[model samples]
Target: MTTRTRTTTVTWSQANARRLDRQSLGGSGSPALGVTEAVAAMLGAHAQVLSAAELAVGVRAPGVTRAEVRSALWTDRSLVKTFGPRGTVHLLPAAELPMWTGALSAVPGEAARLPGDARMTPEQVEAVVTAVAEALTGAELTVDELSDEVIARTGPWAGDPVMPAFQGMWPRWRQALHLAGHRGVLRYAPNRGRKATYTNPGTVPLPGPQATHALVRRYLHAYGPATPAHFARWLGAPRGWAGQLFEGLAAAGAIEEVTFEGVGAAWVAAGDTAFPRSGPRGVRLLPYFDAFAIASMPRDRLFPGAAGDRALAGGQAGNFPVLLVDGTVAGVWHQRRSGKRIAVTVEPLAALGGGRVRELERRVARLGEVLEGTAELTVGAVTVGGHA
Candidate 1:
């Protein structure tokens, strides 16, 4: 006789609150984690905007200043900045670099749709990766410096400006930059004034064949009871491949299927089906591209009702600085710095009561502390557009 698979069901509110708790955004009772610890817990912090990444870590760790976050990345060498989930810049815990590199390297490279002239052949990609590793060894180099070195090592074709960037074309080798990073060839080094730099991170251990499986479990722990499609979206992997991965895990009893309210079928780590009896309650100010806002699934649930219209940018998370109330986005906000003071403007979907108002003030105060500035709160229209 075949055993029927059991599906556990949960309310969206329960999932939200559980994610908040798991992410250390639940409340004041949450422990003040260290910088690396906080980043590791969130899997990684979106870091395209350095200031926002600092705020992301600061909010979760509480009292970890922007300077300290930088220290972890550059001085302490406890965190490494590299291309992370969705092919975006992120600050990930240094110790987990091997696993991340292994898992990301395993992701099938998306076929570049660029014209034949603009794309690098598979052999050219490998050559560029090797050159990048060799060029950055024992020394940090700025983009231009790295480009010159890469060109010298791989001939002029590596420096042919063909890949379009912001307003101009970047070198063909630049296209393989993220791939090299995922292979543990190089990482972001401390900036020289305003110039970004890169350096080889010595040697990273090769990940076991189960590295991808390990990452799947990690993702489910942080944002579980989620569908394979959610995992695909988060990792920027192919949807069918993600589904197959989840299916394999289920077959091995490493994960189990579940029914998420309003979300239909999903999967979570096996035997890990508990949810908090009460939903989370509190106020949180998340900066641009904050990991929690970006990774949580069923965007409609996290940004319920009007929040979907107000907080997201064209259905993409992390475009706006979000205001979280009871584990769901309830408002949008923006901040501007003048000298040592930061002025915060908020536009809530609904009126906040006296208690919540006080909580919001406290959160703003903490944000100021994290930024090493004095912050003033104004509950009104946030006239600013979504950040780039």
Candidate 2:
């Protein structure tokens, strides 16, 4: 005789409430986690735009200033800025670079799928990766400078055209740059001028299946009660591969299946099913690529009606800043800095209660403090996605 494990069941609201707490967006009432803790909580914030990354951290960790976030990245070396999931820049704790890099590198590259004209020989790819690691160690170099060094070390074959873009040809060697970052060999240097630069984060690469497993656990802990498909989408992994990983984890009892109302069975890290039913506590102004905005899925629940259409474009979230009232995205917002003043405009999908508006104002004030300026809030209809 055998007994079957019972799957936990929850409503979307229940899961989201826990997700809010885990993401550190449960409102100020939720204890303010430190910068490192917050980044680790959400795996890593989406950081394609550095400013968006700064604000994403600021909103979750109360009293955190943008300067302080920069200090953590450059001065203290507590946070590492590098290319991460979906081949986008992200801020991961420096201590955890090995795990992230190892996991990311373990995923197979799509070299075979590239057009014949664009594909680099495996030998060429390896040489470029090695050259990048060598050139960036112990010093920061701009892309142009690094490109020159790679060309010098690996021969002209490394610089062949991968593809032609509106700007120019994307080089073969450049394809490995993000791979180099993911393998823990390189990271972004603080912008000294208009050009982007790279540096070694001073960590050795540790590639393995365990690292991938660790990443799966970390992802599920922060954004789980989800399916392998969800994990694949989030990490940009191949669907079959992600599904196998999820299956193995479940067989090992590292994760358990949960059934969410209106959503089918999904996996969450084991012992992660008890989510509080309470909604979030305060209003929040989330910048572009805020982890909460992008990480949460079946997004219609988070972005009902026109809110989804406004905040997301072409199935990508974070084209515009989001206004979170209670636990859901209530509207969209944008800010323009004019010297010492930041002019902010909020475009709510529906009229907000007077108290909620005031709470949003307080959030705006916090942004002002983060920017070291006076932030003025104006209520109006914003043409979302028009301006940066």
**lDDT of each residue in 1-388, candidate 2, tens digit only:** 8998677887887777888887778854566788888888878877777777888888778788888888998899899989888888899999998889888988867536567877777788788888998999888999889989999999987777776656888777887788899878889998868887899876765666788888888887777778888888888888888999888988999988889777799878888777886756668898887777777777778887787787777667777788887778888898989899999999988898899888889989988887778899998978656323
lDDT of 1 by residue, 218-306 (tens): 99988988999999999999998898888899999999888999889888898899988788898999999888898898988899989
lDDT per model vs. reference? 0.90, 0.82
The candidate maximizing TM-score is 1
lDDT of 2 at 159: 76
